[model samples]
Target: MGLTQFSFGALVRTRWAYALRGSQHESLLNTAYALEAAIDEIVFIFGPILAAFLATSVHPVSQLFVPTLACGIGGAVFFSLKNTVPPVLEPIDVVAAEIPDAQSNAVTGQPAPALQTAGDHAAPTPSPEDNGFRLRRLHRPYSAKPRNVLTYRGILPLLVVFVVFNMSFTAFDVSMTATMKAAGAERFLGLQLAMFAVGSCIGAVIFGSREMKGSHWRHMVMFLTLLTVGYVVFRMVMGNFLILGVMEILTGLCVSPLFATGNLIVKDIVPARSLTEGLSWVTTAGSVGTSFGSTIAGAVLDASSPHMSMMIPWIVTLCAVPLALLGWFLARKRPGRGTGRATNTAA
Candidate 1:
């Protein structure tokens, strides 16, 4: 009925689209998303023209309705054009069902023993450095459960990094709009966003076209540092539209690459069976960050200058860099190639 509900629906729809795209590819998923993100930015290039046209209409919400329709039609065409049918998990893969005792245990409603492979027998050990920190200890419940060990090591760090990254993004977005409006160039907002998208397109193409060697976790920190630099440069040009557009190109290039890289990294790190779920958590973290970012940015802009509000995003971006680096460090000790089914294999 309102913008809130429409936004929530769109969020759900986007996650579904990503998951669908993910299911269709084993390689170059990041590249595909990167190219698509670039093309999507073209919409913003035409945005001012579209907004001008829509402004002449009786209602202002035509802007929202048009994009929503376009998205729906696009999704329909994509699904209809797909050649392959979705795969079914076959009965033979259920080792639990084949084992008579486990089947009986399940039928009696008792918990079945978790199936363990040869590799899973080894336990996660703390590094010498980890022994120095109190927080390094797994919490009470997890520590109490000796049989249940943490499978994915990068998860906690990834979660922390994504939350901060999205928070910074949301804060920057809102603050930029406010700053632009205050400066009497509200119309330039879309252009700046488009320019950013253009930059992202370039990044996506470059990274997507190559064979990325080593762990993706390492590149994530590098990209995040680029993001921080962009934000810092952005602060200098906030009062100047021409310079802002150029800055957007530099900053915008970072977006899709970051997202594509993050997506690929998630795919690499999580088990194949849980890929969609892992990606969904990224979406969830973004949503949570957006909510917080919006509240914080709106409050700051009201009480202080846009320049002051701008600090929120850059600070958050700075925070994400180290967190991502930490995640990178953790990934090494954890050691998963993140190539879906091959994660169990040694690097």
Candidate 2:
């Protein structure tokens, strides 16, 4: 249940997610978010630790195989666990389910029935044609119908921002290695990464252990701003390995917390009907970001001096800063952001 709660609750309604009789999607999403944060903290540590143990007997290529094997084994266990899988719906049942809304539904486009009142009229069922019901196969993509994915509600912008932020990170990483090589200390890469991962773990622990009470929007803004600062400092400290290691650690403190904040934001704003897809989009955004970052960083490295290549990350980080601010602004405007009291903020 703990592991598969997310995938298992696909058919769950937002109301049912909170109800006693059904699964609690909110709590499930919360726990999943925590697990994701923990993964970020551990991945960097895992690489070095795994490599150290494998170095004695196995070849270098075998070192790469270890993590891949771990992932496959872990995924098999997750899939085998009856609690993690979502309840499957029949094809007919899937098509029959309407996209629920506060007032009107998407597929049916009819107002939801309110509570019974003394003067309420007797309800009438619509014919199949009237309800837009059609016989169709399961081959169609789910998005062929209108979904409650909030494109205008800052979700797209946040994804864009996430891309740019990770772009900066990848660029910084490429240049960091190049700078270390240029300085004749190429062996320090693992140490720098380890320090950064340690800082991230500490940050995740601090955020996870504390009661999450503030607006996720505000936290996203603050954490991202701090992360931007870290990238800038990464550029400045390239000449000194000691300062570079410390700066990497300091910068890493924002990574897991920023990721957690983004998850919270998605949960708050993305409609329950499209939450799973929306979460997948976020993952896709990171992949796109990584592609943009690594490719551009390579070009920059080829064209400029090692120190000059840092500008790539610096510029991208600035771009992400504005997006983070805009995301925070839009999130503040969303209906429910967890903060009960309203105060003066920017438009």
- For all predicted structures, in order, the TM-scores are 0.69, 0.69
Instruction: Give me the displacement of residue 261 in model 1, in angstroms.
Output: 1.1
**Poorest stretch of ten by lDDT in candidate 1:** 88-97
Q: For candidate 1, lDDT tens digit of each residue in 113-133?
A: 555567886645544433333
The CA lDDT of each predicted structure is 0.66, 0.66
Could you tell me which residue pairs clash in candidate 2?
Answer: 4-84, 8-86
Q: Which residue runs does candidate 2 get wrong by more than 4 Å?
A: 1-32, 48-57, 86-152, 332-347
For residues 1-347, write the lDDT of model 2, one tens digit per residue. Answer: 22433432222222222232234333444444554676666876777767966875787577878766766787567557665334432223345634345555545676654555667677455555544555652344543564556563778788988798878767777887788787777776767667778778777776766645566767777787787787778777778778878887788878887776676566567644455666656766876898898888889889887777787776876787778778777766767533212322223
TM-score of 2: 0.69
